[model samples]
Target chain A: MSILLNKDSRIIVQGFTGSAGSFHAGKCIEYGSQIVGGVTPGRGGTTHLDRPVFNTVEEAVKKTAANVSLIFVPAPAAADSVMEAGKAGISLIICITEGIPVLDMAKAKQFLKTHAPQARLIGPNCPGVITPDECKAGIMPGYIHKKGPIGLVSRSGTLTYEAVHQLSQKGLGQSTVVGIGGDPIPGSSFVDILDLFERDPQTEAIVMIGEIGGSAEEDAAAFYKARMKKPLFIFIAGKSAPPGRRMGHAGAIVEGSAGTHASKIEALKSAGATVIENLSEIGSTVARNFKPVVA
Target chain B: MKLLEYEGKEIFRSLKVPLPEFGGVIDKPAQINSILKRLKKGPWVLKAQVLAGGRGKAGGVKLAKTPAEARAFAKAMIGMKMATHQTHGQTLKVEQVLVEQGVKIEKEFYFSVAIDRKIGSPVVIASSQGGVEIETLAAEHPEQIIKKPLDPVFGLLPFAARALAFELGVPAGHIASFSQVATTLVKLFIDKDMSLLEVNPLVLTPKGFVALDAKIVTDDNALFRHTDFSKRVDIEASPAEREAKKHDISYVGLDGNIGCMVNGAGLAMGTMDTIALAGGSPANFLDVGGAANQERVERAFKIILKDPKVKTILVNIFGGIVRCDMIAEGILAVLKKMKLQVPLVVRLEGTNSEKGREILDRSGTRLITASSLWEAAQKSVAATGGKI
Candidate 1:
């Protein structure tokens, strides 16, 4: 009943022969994700994790009819791998590679618009999406997620896990969690995933985690103001972060009076979302908004 | 990485773009004589080589009508700390001054090629109003600027360049030179994997369109492709920053007493926010990243310890892609090798967290453990004598 992914969704692992790909794919499989096959150039005929492997994404898709492609390719070639997955007609592509050059991603985005407009690219430097207890397509720990009505979307990896852990501790399970990535230009945006959560019947409320950088949060706030149907809570990081210096993430920076924590919080507050000042208050804040749920 | 004005001009010259005649860099007043011998004539421009913008307003850029004036300017600029609005008042030491041939008065225009993330392609922006902030120009008179998006595949077409030149109101005689300069700038941007290439005040002298000033920023991720250019990185980064760069970790120093070690940038920042909320200021921001092996974790610990202001350390690991036990092992290894004077608080969650906790417990190090982020922040702040 979750959005984007469920127990029935078939998956294909890109760069499946690599250590990271094989390891995380095994974890996803253990969590009961329907991993149909894998793709690794030149190692096509081989079998990995008891599934068939193909030289190209097209071959993998043609043989196994895989709907989702999870990428673990290196940073330099990640953009091309995304393009390959899109060209092969995969409906959902999740890239887990980081440190990709911004220019390369720009070209890939252009290529996707013209070549594979239907394909929805999630992240090239993000922790992929997870529909708890149904399917897992990312590097997040599968044990902590619980199946429920709250849909979580964030721009960070571990921070999302922190929120999920808190929600679980509060007996508030989640329907789906998507990490939109922390790059200056991600393939998907907060509004894109919010639109999904808004339409999904299973998701009742949403938790959004954002950090300093870009105007994505402001854009999402504007969207929520106009078309929000559910209670959305937010927690932004990097309030005390120094300006002009990048705060870990490539996109987590305060540029010339823009992308400040105050500005982001003010934008979301004015847009009718409850912005939590502390990370520890997210669980209680969401709990207070909705009726008490029986654990 | 931001390149100095002189280094950016080197790339422009390498791409065959027209620029003011080369004048050597003068780091010392004595070097000014050698630079004058290499340059064309009496009148020259001495620009302080600093990374921040608005150097002209800061008096970093000066005109020297005589060699004695050039020597005086170089002496005053070198070893001086120059501040700019971009640097946020943090002064950058001026190590050298660029000496170039002065040009006659004609006209000034702004030209730059940069990645427009919204459009997912390289965008070339040109304005007849030059030597002013582009942001101000865009806000005040947007119609005065000509914005063109270049095709990533086919690149900047000849017709597109001609169109931009005509739209910028370039004289009919200088159209060819303007087009050449524009094309060359684009080529340099693409060839060197540059994120931004700006030629502010693209001067229109009697000769043609010569770049009066240049500023270039190359992509750090694409540095592997350009080994030579990677070696030219001279940002005067902090020592901790330099060490973190060597180990591929992200670290930013702060003026607090609590050092934070966390996995993932988003979580690292969240940890910092939580620490502040718990009534303690973080000494630095260190993200061990998603794959925190023992070596990287050890290096992160060393970098954090190098900051003498750190009074306590907080280690928060969610262990998603990175295993918690691996981080625990790194911590144990660092504790065994070095004398740690600061109190330590560790929080491990998800993916073999029990095993990681067991390792930390068995190590017998004088450290506090927490099962949640809230508890971790409270414990670290309390350990540092900050009320929670």
Candidate 2:
């Protein structure tokens, strides 16, 4: 009943031979992700973690029938990897590489919108997504996640873990956790995942995390206030972060048109979602919002 | 990052944008005095060259009537630290101050084209109310701001530029000039690989349109293409920021005592948030950026240790793309290399995490291992004697 990924989803690893790619792919496999194969140019015929590798993503997809691709390429070529995956008909692509050029993403987004509108991409610099207790994608750890009804989505990875661990400690498990990536431009938005979470019957409530960048939260706020039927607990990080500096996330900047922590917090609060300013408060907030089930 | 008024003027001049006449960058106070003496055009503007905004309000910009006064102003600014809305008032090299003729503003207007997250395109925002805070304008008089998203393929069409210009109450005759500037701005944005090009108070002079102030921030990730533009980027950034760039850690310094380290930026910020929630301030936001190899981790640790204010070190690695044992090796490396006796709290969650904990447990580094972020923050705060 979770969204995006489950046991049946076939995954492909882009840049599978590189240090980050090979390492995370191995971990994803260990976490029960159906990693069909991998793609690393010039490393064709080589097997990593006993998965067959191909020179191109198109060739890998053709042979392995992989539907989703998680990329770990470095910044410079990261855009091309996403584009290649999109062109190869990979329905869901998650890019875990950070520091991708904004212009590159601008063009990539443009190309994605036009060429493959159905091809969903996650990040060029993001933590990816995890459908807890079933499959893990990107760079998130699998041990901390447990499957339940609460859907967790965030822009920060470690903060996601912090929140998840807290909820897990409180006996509140998650249905899915998606890191939309903290890049200035990401593949999916809060609303995109919210729609999925709303449809998943197992997900009774949601925990959404946002940072100070872009008006995505405001847009999400408007959507939630107008039509969101589920109980949503939210946290917006970087409330005290100074303006202009990129902080840790490529998208976490408080500058002109972006990053007024007050604005994001106020907007989310107005949107009817309980806003938790501190990471430690997310679990308790969600626990209070969601009624306990009696056996 | 913000370019100083003079540096902004340089970018403006390169774009063939009209501005008050200015000469080259001059460092020595005597050079500024000579330049002031040679100009002899009544009172001139002494603008400091820095990478921060709101310099005018910070007294970074001053008008001097005499060459001696200009020299005094230059001298005062040379070794002086100036803080602005965008900076911490760190002292710059005072390489050269621009001596330029001051413009009498008949009208002030705001014009900028930045990437709009909502529209997912570069949006041109224009307002007739210039020189005033755009946020205030947006808040109080929302109608004055005109936003038009530019297509990445075709860019800002002349019609869209004209529309924004017309909405700014630009005269019919000046619309052509403003449109040209707007089109050129789009070109400059694409060519220079800039994320933002702001000209607040694009004043209406008796002569024509002149950019009184310019704020241009190029996309750092696009620096590989804009090699020449990269050369002009402010090299006087904080030592930790500069060092982080070398090791690929996206570290930003803060005024706190706990030196925090995390593998992802969101996590790093969350750790900072958790520390603050626990009543401890984080000294820096260091994201080792998924590279938890010993070399990168040691480099990050060294950079964190450079901050004399950091009383304790908090290392939280989720170990997604990076293994935890490798992180352990890095902590040991930092412990051995710097011999840091500061209180250390380490939290590892992910692949080979137990091995990572084992390495730290046996390293003889006397580091605290927290099972969770809560315990880690408490340990870090306690290590700082609970003040931070």
Candidate 3:
């Protein structure tokens, strides 16, 4: 079974009337995810894509029993959508919108801590998650995936896709792939996803793709070293990146000796992780390190 | 985006944080008279308005005893290129000089309010050891520095700021003002969506604690909320990089020869790493964004070609959900129109990628196609006369 999503997940899209929301929600529906209903503020009585629409998240939740909320709101109003979803008791919220003010996100996270502690938020600036063959909740390509054993988590969107393409080529599929996002303060952490992956019965091994930012990777290493028995193959981006240069839109910056690529690699290696130094070898290294899982 | 010292001080002044009296910002040597009229001073500090740190030790800052001295300093600094350790090796060109009245300091202390990534909140840091050597001080004596993590929702407490002020060894007379500066700065950090707000050598003069210098980096993601600073330019970017920004492309210039045009940021960084692994250096980091069409393709090529060091261009586009044939046709269409100068190596992956590969093969335009990253990187490196 996948950790956060599966066949039973009833998903609803926020900002459903908008182009981004409708497009991705349609893609998810195309991949067989249950697009139960949606919420788009002013257009309450109207219906789009053969789904009922509600003005508020509470009414949508009550009407459709949507357990998973996928947010595609714009940056300025995105955090409000997150808080509203949490307030409506959406257990799993996957936000696909990027560039929400960090302070807004941080405050929303704090609100969720007391308001709906049970809600697990995936990202506010990330490509969502997908449990291949069963459900595709995010914007990830549905074709490259096949039902298998690897549980993947990453901070990047297309980089996760790149890793999946490599794994798929090797005839190794995944249990669930979670994109935790690349924001300075994301909704979920590596440790949280790692905990879920460790407990999931379907996940045999895990692959984590971290980059030059934050202490998330190192924190994961420190927390999961001795406890995790499954083979963990990891790859970090930005080894060739210069210090003080931000590599991307998200929090991919190498600062001093703290969040450098080399330091992250060293930390993960010391924690008994099989670190893939070469980008092209992520799949091959995983194949060599673990007992093969047929696709 | 990083703010220059003068710009940061402008914010600090607006927030009512005590700062050294601003003489003037001089674009030319003749503008020193503006400082003399406003400051009415004999001694002034002439500082190059640059984003680099360690400017004091790098000769970017100097003390001017007279108007003639300030004019001379301004003349020498206005168009000067100066480098510090923070600049990584390249020099930053000084376009303006900030001439401020020099104040006598009883003591110096470091104060800053910045986002703490690990805690996922704002943190206030202070140290009695200040000045340009604060980095060295932190490296040598970590205990001298004190930190207080704050919740951005509730903001920093006055008592907490007082404690930080006290611990940083501010005298009793200046504690009130110091705490005021600390609180205001924290509020400014939250309100302005700043990533970092540093007041180096927040000096204690005879009257009170005065901010001798200021540095700020506003969050680019939150720039939409603040329209004034939205048009941010990376002071360290090369000409090609600045042009790429105007074209809405993410490109960072590097000291390499193989120009890399990749699909994603993470993949772009990874591509650069792989290129380095293949015994080839990447000329720049270019993420052509998710949807790469004819216009973006032409724009990306133009930016990459602007870099004279680029010997080969490696285009790695990973198609997700969107079919690659359309993107491939767009790339081919763009490629056909351009008077190409360098070897172009392309790798297209994802749905309908095989058809896209066929299109590239049939086009007969000079191109090298690879199915994998390794093959593409190696081919690109070989095109640049590198052996792997």
Each model's RMSD to truth, in Å?
2.0, 3.2, 1.9
- Which residue pairs clash within candidate 3? none
Native contacts, share recovered per candidate: 0.75, 0.62, 0.69
Q: Chain A TM-score of each model, in the order shown? A: 0.98, 0.96, 0.98
Q: Give the per-residue lDDT digits (tens) of candidate 3, residues B258-296.
A: 998887788899899989998899999998876666788
For model 1 the local lDDT of residue B369 reads: 97
Candidate 2 lDDT over B17-53, as tens digits, reads 8887674456777678567656767577777777665
Candidate 1, CAPRI quality class derived from DockQ = medium
CAPRI tier for the interface of model 2: medium
Estimate, for each residue in A37-66, the C-alpha lDDT of model 2 and write its tens digit. 898899899888899999999999899888
TM-score leaderboard ranking: 3, 1, 2
Identify the candidate with maximal TM-score: 3
TM-score of each: 0.96, 0.90, 0.96
**Superior by lDDT: candidate 2 or candidate 3:** 3
For A100-199, candidate 1 gives per-residue lDDT tens digits of 8887888888889999998999987898989998999999998889988899999999999989988987889999999988887799989999999999
lDDT (0 to 1) per candidate = 0.88, 0.80, 0.87
Model 1 ranges off by over 4 Å: A292-295, B386-388
Minimum summed lDDT over a 10-residue window in model 3 chain B is located at B230-239
DockQ of candidate 1 (2 decimals)? 0.70
